[model samples]
Target: MNRFLQQPIWRFYDQSISMKYNSPLESFATDDTLCQLVGQLQSPPTIRTWVHDAAVVLGIQDHRLPYVQQGMKVLEARGYHPIVRNSGGLAVALDTGVLNISIVLSEQAEALSIDAGYDVMVALVKALFPEAADKIEAYEIVGSYCPGSYDLSIQGKKFAGISQRRLRQGVAVQIYLCIEGSGAKRAALIRDFYEVSLQGEETKFAYPQIVPSVMASLSELVDASLTVDTVVIRLQQILHDLAHEVHMEPFHDEELTLYSFYLQRVLQRNAKMLEPK
Candidate 1:
């Protein structure tokens, strides 16, 4: 299956400007908008990059924990807005120091497998940093928030996690790359979130017992001063090199309208889950 799938098969569309919303909520809303566009074939497959000021995106499982509300309170007190995401994975940290990218592709292209989607993003990362790419490996990275087989790590320290959102016939493979700042501190935030949400109570599902030291930002892991902006630029360079022609444009007004619908749906989903019994 690996050899049969062509390299660089996905069409690349880049959004020109960063989203208007400084909050993660708005960023997520934009992702849904793009997802719908790609799903409907109204837009080409895209590789969009975005940054949120400071936010903690909680997974659906994280919301089910008995004391998630209290965990959110801690996030709020620390000046980070918390919002639940419509994807897999546990809680993850996002901020100006982080770079979030989504690769929206057609599922019909070639029987898109879950691992294939993950590898596409992994391949992109490897191309971007060839020097450190060899050191980049995928594993559970135990003790890391959102532990998964595709967790992107270097020397045992995880710097990024991947998730997917599939719509009608389109697949959006997403990853949050921690480019700068203290990776351990972000992990600590999630560690504390679990502590608050679980309060040491055991549950049917085993949540990761987070060890902050296991996660480090790309800058820390590579021993180079890297910023989100720098990483974004590198991404652009790679896209240009790979694509026949790359255009940076903003979402059309019509696309924004679709996003409005998806955003409302996301809000309603969260509302229904939070409703009192």
Candidate 2:
């Protein structure tokens, strides 16, 4: 068990239910704000869960695609909004069935190594679904979108991807769990995006060659009927069991001001990234 997971108290916020902060832009901004709050010792370690309707979040490297605009059009045709994220990693698909979790912890006392942060998320996900503990593995799924060292997979099929952000002495370890629907179908979207964007041109960064079959939803992997709501309940239960207390403490008014600042910065950066080249 990771020491970070056993914090004395954790602040819990569930935005997936209300769908109020469902946009990828707002979600990223909120994470940044939480990073600042937690890093400054204004808030305790926080766990946030969220979901977006239909989005394809591109990475910093993704913006360099030769035909990127046309690639975004493909996603838009399928009712998915495409936007670049302020994090490291390639493109990833997000829909109503996907659940996003962020474990924000302060580094005031001790800083977490990059791998340590990822390990904590892996441990939590394993704890969340104990039945699949033996099957779950953390290794890069070659044909999966956003392939990384910490890609969560069953057998050779990936169901989740984790990324991290460090700001203001805080570390936010975030993961998007494909809980329902077709993970391969989502992978197909990214495959198409890359094929169109790359146009067989070589680039400095080696964007993934996504194989749709290499990805599967958690429900698909475990052979169980798992939904976003049920996963949220399970996560809450796990938090309560791990920590002495879990509080549903949302942002204070002052925190809202920080959120707004981050929101604008994210918005501005996204707009700038997508500008005509």
Candidate 3:
């Protein structure tokens, strides 16, 4: 039973546990909760979408920046809240223009390779935009924010990047797609952030040297104006068409209760990361 080939997808896009509304922490914690629920088979395989307004989600490694405090201040002053996420990747900007999709898979289906998870997302994203699917390629977009091998690109400019989180018996493959606004401006923001954060301090891990030109929004790449809401509907339709059963499942009372615990776990982890030295 290949899960990817024959799993019913539960849509949890509109109904999520991010009660905090604008807090990226809420979004992150909710993902953790969903991962746990799906892991325990309390919930079906799920697809969730979220957008946090004016936020810069940092990787754990990003906390080591020589002047990270100052770098955070820069982001704050620029109207973006800076947060450290437990997910894979570094320094991604989120706003109304950016849309995040998480595909939750129950480990019961089988143990899937990392590439297999990423391929699932890449395939879905391409499927969502068949008009430009042929041009969308996944590779490491050098000089781009959060550069990764699964970076989804058009020509040489990247529009999205895939990341993942594994917990208990579930795997959540996540991707952030730049759907509208200026992707270069977002890259430039991170570029300036690193300049302030690094401040000439050498670190064990090499951070990306962001080149704004290497990043772009899907609208820019595809030459069409796209909005998050529009994409959300399209994604839901695609999933509905692909799966024999598509159910709208929200968090149950037990899951909500569990969310409080996971939320604290995420909060504590973030506190440790952002704790002042």
Candidate 4:
């Protein structure tokens, strides 16, 4: 048994229920909020689930594109609002069908290594879909958007990607799972985004040469119709089976107040990221 999958306690938060913080900006802030709390020992190791409607969360590298303004405009035209995130990844499409999970953990004695954080997320995902446990592979899917060593794929098609954020004394391991809808279509959106953002301009950074066919949804890859709700249920069941105690507590007033402060910081950072050059 992987120790990463043997977490004794887990605090669960399902934002998909209220659909309140379903926007990209709110989603990022929510993670930051929980990360700060857990890092401060105000909360336990946490697992949060959220889904945004339509947004493209870009990384710092993507913001430096020669024609980034044009790319943002392109995304806006396509009904996907673009925002640069405080994480390490290129442009990734987010929608109703995509499920985002954040595992926030406190740095007990030593700082968690980056690879260790990613491994935890990978283990969590595999645990969530134990039926397809061996099928999940963590490797960079060449030509996939936001290509990374931890891009989660099955067979040859990529469906999810893991990224980590560390703050204070906490680590937030995040994964965006394409639970439903057309994964190739999402890839195409990023491909077009790069096309518009780069506009034949050369740069020090190497952007991904996205191949839409290489990206797919978990539903398509597993050959089973997995909706966001269905996956959330599976997550709850998995946690229940794996953990000795699963805490599902609503945010208190103090937490909400602290969240507002973190959210404000995120908003300001995003506004600056989206500002015209």
- Highest TM-score: give the candidate number: 2
Please list the residue runs of candidate 2 whose C-alpha ends up more than 4 Å from where it truly belongs after superposition.
none
Question: On residues 1-277, what C-alpha lDDT tens digit does candidate 2 reach at each position?
Answer: 7788999999998998675336699999999999999999999999999999889999999999999999999999999999899889999999988999999999999989999999999999999999999999999899899999999999999999999999999999999999999999999999999999999998988999889999999999995688999999999999999899999988889999999999999999999999978
- RMSD for all candidates, in order, please: 2.6, 1.0, 2.1, 1.4
Ranking by lDDT: 2, 4, 3, 1
Expressed as tens digits, the lDDT of each residue in 71-100 for candidate 4 is 988999999988889988889999888999
Instruction: Report lDDT (CA) for all predictions.
Output: 0.79, 0.93, 0.85, 0.87
Q: TM-score of each candidate?
A: 0.91, 0.98, 0.95, 0.96
Candidate 4 residues lying further than 4 Å off, grouped into runs, are none
Which pairs clash inside model 2? none
lDDT string, candidate 1, 1-277, tens digits: 2232233433444332355246566666667777777667777667888777668988878888878888888998897878888888989988778888888777555567898889988888877777798999998999999999999999899999999988877778889898889899999998998999899888888889999999999889885778877777887777766666665667678777887888788888777765533
Report the lDDT of model 1 for residue 24.
Answer: 63
User: Which pairs of residues have clashing backbones in candidate 1?
Assistant: none
Displacement of residue 175 (Cα, Å) in model 3 is 0.5
* Shift in Å, residue 157, candidate 4: 0.9
Poorest lDDT segment (10 consecutive residues) of candidate 4? 16-25
Model 3 score (lDDT): 0.85
